[model samples]
Target: MIYFVNILPQSNGDHVIHTENCAHLPNMRQRTILGYFKTSMEAIEVAKKNYAKCNGCRDCSEAIYNNYN
Candidate 1:
């Protein structure tokens, strides 16, 4: 699946990663494409290289969000 990371930081300073189909996925102007990934973890790992405090969107990447959020 395709994934993306929000360009804006969360209130707690995390940059949220979301699946393309996520309910809360940000608009193109507000996010950075993370590329096609087999799993949310893969996208999250890529997001982490650029954003130290990256977490997954709870609605679409629940397993990832649960681990970090």
Candidate 2:
């Protein structure tokens, strides 16, 4: 399966990352594309390097937690 992540730039200059299917994702007009990966973990890894986790996305947060723990 393919995995994807989005990088959202905040007004304060911080960034947030969300899974492609994240329910909290911004509207299409406000969304930004980071890139796609072969695995969720891969996408998460890249996101971790540049952005903070989005607490609004439970699936994305759980995936990261499960993968690391």
Candidate 3:
């Protein structure tokens, strides 16, 4: 899947990682392309390279979000 990371941080200070087609995905100007990956884990790991706190999208990557929580 093609993933993206929100440039804007959430109130909890997490930059959410999302699948390309996620309903909750941030607008283009507010997100950065995170490359293609088979799993959300790969996308989250990539986001973590720059952001200190990253979480998978609740709507698209529920499994990853659950693991992080």
Candidate 4:
């Protein structure tokens, strides 16, 4: 029932991706994605997109939950 906001880089560091809501998720818990971005915006975009995709995925919530755990 929580969310986290994360900034991850794309493999080439060209964009930054965001995650749930950082306030909800902690450092010890987070899904692992390979990305390298030059700025945080790009990462946020990716995370947002993933979140949208995860909305329909039953396993996605669990994945995020596990990472946050």
* TM-score per model over all chains: 0.91, 0.44, 0.93, 0.32
> What are the per-residue Cα lDDT tens digits for candidate 3 across 1-69?
999999999999999999989999999899999999999998888898999888888899887885763
Please give the CA lDDT of all the candidate structures.
0.88, 0.52, 0.90, 0.35
For residues 1-69, write the lDDT of model 2, one tens digit per residue. Answer: 333344455555434445576766667665556577665566566666655543223455455543432
Could you give the candidate ranking by TM-score, starting with the highest? 3, 1, 2, 4
lDDT of 4 by residue, 1-69 (tens): 223343332343322223343333325344545255543434444566644322211232333332321
Error of 1 at 53 (Å): 0.3
Stretches of model 4 off by over 4 angstroms after superposition: 1-29, 52-69
Q: Which is the winner by TM-score between candidate 1 and candidate 3? A: 3
How many clashing residue pairs, candidate 2?
A: 0
lDDT of 4: 0.35
Whole-model lDDT, candidate 1?
0.88
Residue ranges of candidate 1 with Cα displaced over 4 Å:
none
Q: Give me the candidate number with maximum TM-score.
A: 3
> Quick one: how many clashes does candidate 3 have?
0
User: Model 1: which residue pairs collide?
Assistant: none
Greater-lDDT candidate between 1 and 2: 1
How high a TM-score does candidate 1 get? 0.91
Ranking by lDDT: 3, 1, 2, 4
